[model samples]
Target chain A: MEINGKKYKAVVIGGSAGSFSVVSKILSKMSPDFPLPVIVCMHRLKHVRSGLVEGLNLKSKIKVVEPCDKDKIEGNKVYLAPSNYHLFIEFDNTFSLSTESVHNHSRPAIDYTFSSAAYTYRDKVLGIILTGANKDGANGLKDIHDKNGTTIVQDPASCDIDTMTKAALNLFEPDYILTPEKIAEYLNQLAS
Target chain B: MARFISKTVPTLSSFERGLGLGLKDVRELSAFMSDVLGIPYDHMPVSFFKRRLTNVFAKNNIRNVEHFKELLTSGDIKENIYHDFSVSITEMFRDPGFWRYLRSLLQNLSPGKTFTVWFPDASSGEEVFSFLILIAELNMLDRIKVICQHPSSRITEDIRKGILRNKNAEVNANNYIRIEGNGNFKDYYSLQDNIFVLNTYLLQNVETVTGHFLNTAINEPAGLIMFRNKMIYYDKEVSEKGIKTLTGKLSPGGLIAIGGKEKMPESTMSSFKCINEKERVFKKHGFDISWNNGN
Candidate 1:
């Protein structure tokens, strides 16, 4: 991503069913010198308290924290949406937690995060929709592609559960079709 | 938890069938009808008519739904019965910490400035009495004028009489004395005919009025407007409108006290500073355009 005429890179990976292992595997492949932020989203129960930040911190080299309302998205940091709140990407590169009711009964929903990123970042955005049970990330990945951003999906056969990945893949022609390991390699290459 | 199974829950199919009325109309009509019938709205999707049905069932001990429905359609109803239906079972100083926090703000007010206090949706004289007692304790009643609003005519009568001799007063008085001190309550009122007559002193001193906040013209140059736990039922936009109206009524450097759960819209908070963030006590420092030109 080129921000303020300077070149910087960032990635957004969205998933649900197999997201925990996918996120860990992707983060483990990146070198210590990875120069950009990698934000992730997985569907969460509205009322259940989020342990994603603490859970992710144990596996990833990057510092993981629950994004505060209106906290700026900084590079090399992993910001997870808090439980029971939809995380919206503001135009000014900050997060907004909405209590304005849930969409699809999931807060930190894949659709919410991806749509906002597509709106704000446009072509600078890299949206990766991964394996999950629902079709949430399907239309959202389309939104990223419609906004001229790159959209990627896990290959259905490589996915543990192909419902969500196949939904994205069949609905939208993702720019890169790969397994989780190869997707990690592709992201590492993009970071360089 | 005393087997907290709420028996007043309405037939869920009513909501499903009522869905044909359009989502917005169904929601609005349900609320209006709920108020029209004195119904215990313990059910998730409470309808005004269903609340009445539940109350009728409980009152007649008619466990059969068909019998309850027959009574509802009997078309034998009297007016003035619904007046008691609006009896909001609110406890005195329901959130004690909020009152203590409010009392602190009252104490901190500058002595020279006169403050107009308005309690929109005062709902019975409990809050008005609570405010009056707080003001008297602070010796700020002389410097303040109170304007209160409630839907109940009974509350208006109680405020005018300046006496509270309800069963609730005994429990409330204990809580009131804990903060306001024991001997302090004695100076306000005396018992007469087994009902505590609000000493004519507080009534003569504080100006209490009866009016719906929606219709009432808010011309008073208020310095402190307290609207507690009233707008929770309203939509976010409606809440903003009421807050803006109250903000317009406030004098420059005025303070607005809202319910702890309520918040000023991010765009609306620019002109005000949070005095006690957790207590939702906000002080106005200057005028903002949002509340200026009545939208």
Candidate 2:
């Protein structure tokens, strides 16, 4: 699946439950010089804050770090939403973290990141919804699609837990629906 | 190219207006709050006020701003509205790295001199309790003095007694482990009828005051002032005023820590030097250099 020569500024990936390994696989296969900022918004245990980023860093070619509040968004890096904070992509292309009440029973809610990125980046965004047990990313993926941004959902049959992908498919028609391996191939092709 | 977005989104204003809440309506409401509750709601960020008002309206089942205004003018729901507006969400040892940096800074302070710290917004006492635990762990409880201030007397009283809601236990315990490396967090508190009560012994150096830091006159200077995450609720002008008030209370060379997301207004930058820019830690200038460097 080619992007048809459209230049994208940012890529936002939202997942939950079984998405960690899928995200790790994508990141490990991504080239070191990949030129777009990748934002990962995953539902993580609020109590266990230390291990996810470190675990991702060990296998990923690109740098992965949990963003502090107001950290500038930059290319060739993977920014993970920190636990217990709802991460919003501000118009300035920097992150603003909020400790406001949780949404969809999750802080670091995928909807917040995806909607904000869609609003801020508009048609320049590429949003990908991966494996998860809940419907957290459905509205967000729809928002991206509504804003003329490219939206992708991992095929429900390919996901370990298909609830999230099925939810997205039920909500709106995404630009692409493929397995994790195909998703990585598309991302690599986009980079080139 | 990054451009500044207006702090108050247009959609919120139109939505409020559709509900019969125009600028004049908000102004009148702000005036009523100031006169009745002593809170300067006029100075709050419009977006923040709108969000809170939406919650207030939904919770109270108020039909519109006009109905809410009538209820406010009646004077029966002042306390309820105040309580709803003042409910702060905070966690213990928020940003573990900031706490670790604070620990090192406290250790570097001049030995044998009493250290003074202030919590201008001690909402629910998580931060105050977290600091007390740190001081106790360092065995410097005797050498430290803490003053906690909140707008509600009830909250102040609860904090003075070291009472905290149990909902934050898991996050607090996780942060404590990150800070301490290894230990049972239960050693510091006892469960009393489902609430976590800090050991009163650790409260020796802490005092709670019922007042608004923005309006209260504080004569004492503090070595460290914690006013984190509260500024985001205020408009630019009020945020500037609050920053000035807090900075005025700092002793020379003392440090002030703000929320990581907050930025020091350019107007106030000359008075304090950045210590940890990412953590929003700043130290007031004009103290003898040797005092910090240890000559």
Candidate 3:
């Protein structure tokens, strides 16, 4: 779980546009005993409250659930940012949700999760940007990079929407640009 | 009954966020803020408080933590602190499904007797208007009593005048449609110098509590308490305290609707049954009693 001499504390995945299937594949391949918690923030229809967790839980070996406010950041579980709320991972290892103004036109904006994780966990965070139509995760991924955390992005060629990963690439070089299967393999290896 | 201001809440230190306020600065500031905002502000998570405090600092040109305290003590930034510290950011019909579900629930109620719907934290007018529209559409306006409460008189007056930022009109229209709104959403509001003003007619018989009720005011038990999105800023202990207070004020089997994403505080969960998981509405555990629809 150590990367560059720092043991990773958690994995934060940010996605939008068409990332569900890739996330599902990564989750399905991840082992049940994955060492760190997986925090996922994806843009969703604000009013449509259900379905993401239900779909992800069906195939993933690990449990996937939307976390309530102040829920602890625990290992071996997936915490999906709930709809219509910006989710921040606090330094106290609890999730803080806010109804603040939308950034990048999204609640559950991936940047907030990634940037907050970088601030909280610093070099111990592993931030991954996946398929999205916007540049929501670009600055956040760079923040993780600047903080010495591991950064990964889905290969733009493999993404359903390449805009997201390309934006990250334009901002700063990532640690890895891999397909869904390779990302899964990389995550599984990191859990050890 | 217990109150959020009555209990000890965890005060946050080490506010190492984007705001450059130091640990000592926050401690000193919070000490003074607690007098004005009460304990609930102290109980707010460091992250949320930092955001609001950041707004205050930026708005008031607070040069440093000490300067910020000086402005506060001099009464220079009193209005700014009150305006920006409280979260006034909420949407009209934020969660359309919850409003729809509530509409159905109210329609089933006996309109023969007046029912009570209390907004314990109506920071904005959109939500109050949404419920008023629902009642009006159901032809239950005369039979349903509404109470909107907020600590800030300025906020209360803003809401009383139907002043709302015009940003969410499109989304609100869509949500109104989702609730099977029969009339056009535009019919309920008027454009006033770029702001959307909810027609004051919808506020008939609507009681506005402009001051903090201190959680001690006793009136007829409320059949529904609309307290959504307000508890997300609070920590576990504080939320439990507030929920316990609200539970005591609930009518027998009355319903409390919170934000869809928020969870009920653990200590107060046993006293209520979750009737809708997606909408995050709970019914107080008590014998069901019908309202008296008498004149």
Candidate 4:
């Protein structure tokens, strides 16, 4: 069960602007039998909820979906944060969506999800910060670090929009800073 | 060595806010709230309850759980205390497509047949106001009655007053426009001192009910029950109870509209056929989709 020398319960990735293609590429590289559930929190237009999942599904070896409230987290699947709702991984490991006030100007705020994942999984969570234009996910990723969870930020030099990852980098030291390909490779290695 | 090098590049290294409440505090608050308010704060997801607890503490400027507990047990502001912990964030025409489908459903109602729409928990006024405007637009105001319920009297009063101001009026108008709304959206409301107050005619049919309407049986079964997004705040048993209550309140062939992101309990979901999966609109077994086909 050791991934990168430690077993992890869940993998959470957060991104905003310019993250779609990178996420799609990363998901495309994942093996169909990827052993850990991938939970993604990406900022998106609230009303237009369809295309993102469909696009990810097309590129992913595993299914991509906007999870309904109380949906169980399962391996080899990607759960996209639904539009306008902040997604949380409850203590029971089920997904719950909230219309809570925006944090860092994002409703599906990465901080809420990453914070929940860290709190639920503790040291067994792996959090990744990807390219984005806002500071939403920085505090959440820091929560993971504080809990001894593994944290990674996509290298800002490679990010199309570096604000998000750089913000996270400024908050706390992540385990590694990687490119999209390297992030995918890291995930694939974890699955193996 | 590569791994060692990554550690040297620390930048700001300044950690800000953290998720504060622990599981023990969460359980304590839930138990206290259940004992004091008789509401199932425990039945809510732990993370949600934790956040709600943190919110309550911060909102009231309480030093800690002990402080919050003292204020509640003191009973001077018991009603306000209960109201503060409840969460309901909604916007007018939230999921604008849902409103569009609703208009289509109302278009098919048989002439002279009265339809009752129930908002089992209209914690926020936006959804209720949106429905009222839709009903009024269809010119079916006389035949339709809405039973609106909320734990907060303040919210109910806002709905009763037709106050749309400070409630994202501009965003709501944009959503209305997104749905290809007919005529001027402004025609439905007025600007008094730069506040958008909905026309009074729309409020005439709204009936505000207090107490736990979920457990109480309505004399008239509702044609449509909108229990949207509210149950995401709850855990399994309470949400199921809510679904059962919604089903019981609906007429034999009536429909249930839940939040687009919510899932009905497995047993209940299988029993009610999905009418609009995208919008999370489901119908009781007796309902026929062909009725609204407009063919």
Give the root-mean-square deviation of each candidate in angstroms.
Answer: 14.9, 7.3, 8.2, 2.9
DockQ values, each candidate: 0.02, 0.09, 0.29, 0.48
Instruction: Judge candidate 4 at residue A29 and give its lDDT.
Output: 92
Clashing pairs in 4: none
Better of 1 and 2 by lDDT: 2
Q: Cα miss at B158, model 3 (Å)?
A: 1.6
Interface RMSD of each: 19.2, 12.4, 19.1, 4.5
- Model 1, residue B80: distance off in Å is 5.0
Model 1: per-residue Cα lDDT over A82-125, one tens digit each: 66455666555766554323445465677767766776676788
Backbone clashes under 3 angstroms, per model: 4, 0, 2, 0
- The order of the candidates by DockQ, greatest first, is 4, 3, 2, 1
Mind giving the per-residue lDDT tens digits that candidate 2 earns over B12-128?
122222344545666677776677667778776443454467767877888976787788879766655765676456578888887887787777767777867899877777888
- Per-residue lDDT over B1-295 for candidate 4, one digit per residue giving the tens place of the 0 to 100 score: 0121333334332212323556776787788887886677778888777777666666777786677788888975466655566665546888999899989888887777787889887776778888887887788899888888776677666677877545577778898897777768888888888876889988898888754565455677888888889889898788988898788777777888999999888867755878788888888877522336321
Give the candidates in order of TM-score, highest first.
4, 3, 2, 1
Model 2 Cα shift for residue A97 (angstroms): 1.8
Candidate 2 residue pairs that clash: none
> Per-residue CA lDDT of candidate 3, range B81-188, in tens?
766777765577778888888877876776486667888777778888888888888888888788888776777787778788647888888889888887888998
DockQ, model 4, C-alpha based: 0.48
lDDT per residue for candidate 1 within B1-295, as digits (tens), equals 0111112322122211222333354455445433544331221122223333344444556556444344444633312223332334233554566677777666555555566788776656666777777777777767778886655566667667765645456556666755654255556667788776766656556665555565574577787787765544343455676777777788777778776445676667876888776567787876421222111
Candidates 1 and 4 compared by DockQ, better number: 4
- Per-residue error at B82 for model 1, in Å? 8.2
